[model samples]
Target: MNWIILVIAGLFEVAFTSCLGKAKTTTGNEAYWWYAAFALTCGTSMFLLIKSTETLPLGTAYAVWTGIGAVGTVLMGIFFFHDPATFWRMFFIATLIMSIVGLKLVSAH
Candidate 1:
């Protein structure tokens, strides 16, 4: 299903972002490896997004994709990157999750 593909693409987006974060924190060959992973995952995410968009409404699909990426990246930041998990930040993330669900429910696919 296109939705599944879209979700996978979004996950790849998360992975690419995580790779970027790792790259930022490291040095030399380790950083280069993370950057390489970032490129690979980013390309895969884009490819999957394009494939899903063939059957999905562009606006809805893009919003959902970015929403998934944003939520996932934020969670990764909190859990792995030692970013702050303030109440308001968590509240907004929850709202983003709800909005993503709402979009899926209303989609005509």
Candidate 2:
């Protein structure tokens, strides 16, 4: 299903962005490989997004995809990268998630 593919694509977006963060923290050959992985992962993510767009509304698809990516990235930063996880930050993330859900519920499949 297109929705399934879209969700996978969003997960890929998270993967690539996390790879980017890891790449920045490395050096030399390791960094180069991480960068390469990031590029490949991002490319795959975009390809899936394009495929999903064939059946889903463009605006809804893009917003949900980006929302998933944003939430995943923030969580990864807090859990893996030891980034700050303030109350306001968590609150906004929850709000973003709710919005994403609301969008999905309102969208005509």
Candidate 3:
């Protein structure tokens, strides 16, 4: 389904973002590899997003996709990168999540 594809694309967005972060910390060959991975993953994510847009409204699809990616990337940062999980950060993340759910519910699937 388009929704499933969108979700997968969002997940790939998270993966590519994480890879980008990792790339920033490396040197030479390792950095190049990470950059390549980032490029590939980003391409795949975009392709899936384009596919989903064929069925979903452009605005709805884009917002939902980016919303999912943003949430997932933040969580990945907190968990894998050991980034700070301040109360306000978590609160806003929850708020974003609620908004995402609201959008999904209101969207004519």
Indicate which candidate wins on TM-score: 1
- lDDT by candidate, in order shown: 0.98, 0.96, 0.94
lDDT of 1 by residue, 1-109 (tens): 9999999999999999999999999999999999999999999999999999998999999999999999999999999999999999999999999999999999999
Model 1, position 67: C-alpha lDDT score: 99
Candidate 1: deviation at residue 18, Å?
0.4
Q: Write the per-residue lDDT of candidate 3 for residues 1-109, one digit (tens) a residue.
A: 9989998999999999999999999999999999999999999999999999999899988998899999999999999999999999999999999988998899898
Question: Model 1: what TM-score?
Answer: 0.99
What stretches of model 3 exceed 4 Å from their correct place? none
- Which numbered prediction scores highest in lDDT against the true structure? 1
Q: Any runs in candidate 2 off by more than 4 Å, and if so which? A: none
Error of 3 at 67 (Å): 0.8
Q: Where's the lowest-lDDT run of ten residues in candidate 3?
A: 100-109
Candidate ordering by TM-score (highest first):
1, 2, 3
Question: What is every candidate's alpha-carbon RMSD to the true fold?
Answer: 0.4, 0.6, 0.8
- Pick by lDDT: 1 or 2, better one: 1
